[model samples]
Structures are given as C-alpha cells and as structure tokens.
Target: MNMREKTTKAENTPADKVEIAVRLDSELLEQIQHLTNDPSKVIEVAIRQWLRGEILRDDELTRTPVRTPVPPRGEWND
Candidate 1:
C-alpha cells in the first residue's frame, strides 16, 4: 500500500454522502465528539429510524382507518 492510501481520510466514507453543515453550541458539540467516535453514524441512524416510523405509520393508518400516533423509536419496530 502506498503512503497516499494510508493517509487518505475517505477510506471508510460512503461513496454517496450528502454534504451538510450545522452550527452547534460549543458544549453539546464537545459532548458528542467526546462521547461518540462516529457522531455522523449516530445521526444517520436516528434519521433513518424517524423516516421508517413515518412510513410504517402511514401504512398502518391505511389498513386500520384509525388516527393512531406512530410508536416512539425502538418501540413498535426495533
């Protein structure tokens, strides 16, 4: 392996990543960085779960005809 490959930061990055920028308060930002090695992955999982719940809730409503709220994360579908 060449030195360039060893030094590259994109080694584990997905090929299709959407660039986004957020401004975080200093304390919360530091807490996340210090507590989690991969904050991006944590955020990604959270978003995916939220989207999944929405989709599931929509399908459920169509079949049941009741205005029930979607179960919180890690509840109905884990």
Candidate 2:
C-alpha cells in the first residue's frame, strides 16, 4: 500500500527487550507485527525520532543565559 501503511504494518513485531504501547486496529496490528516483529522497537524508534525533532525545534537552548543580575552602579561603590 502506502508508506504509512507499510510502516504501520512493520511496527508490531517483537524484538529484543523493550515495551511500548500502540493503538491500532487488530488487523493493522497483526499486519505490522507480521512485518516488523518488534512493536517496542518501532515505537521506541518513533519516539526517539520525535524527541530529537522537538529538541532541535527548540532553538532557545543557546539563547538563554542563567546568571545573577549585576547590581546597579549606584549601589556598587565598593
């Protein structure tokens, strides 16, 4: 079918050691399980990809600085 269909079908199989929750039609799940044989891996990979995107999307990482404010000139004569 389409890429999504292919991916979905390929994401339900069992791999090494990992657990993930996915909601889909039974038929779709079965199809995916048959193809991927590791649902957890599929979900893990997807989540990691999404998180990476989000991390990169937040461009404020380098723009914000945390430091104590400098006292006003009038108060700092010492």
**Candidate achieving the largest TM-score:** 1
Model 1 CA deviation exceeding 4 Å by range: 1-12, 54-78
What clash count does candidate 2 reach?
6
Each candidate's lDDT (Cα)? 0.71, 0.66
Residue 26 lDDT in model 2? 85
Point out the worst 10-residue segment of candidate 1 by lDDT. 53-62
lDDT string for model 1 (1-78, tens) is: 887658544555577886566776888777887868877776678688898874355656668565879888889755
Local accuracy of candidate 2 as per-residue lDDT tens digits, 32-71:
6886986666666767889887435556766777899999
TM-scores of all predicted structures: 0.40, 0.33
Please tell me which predicted candidate would have the highest lDDT against the true structure.
1
For candidate 1, give the lDDT of residue 73: 83
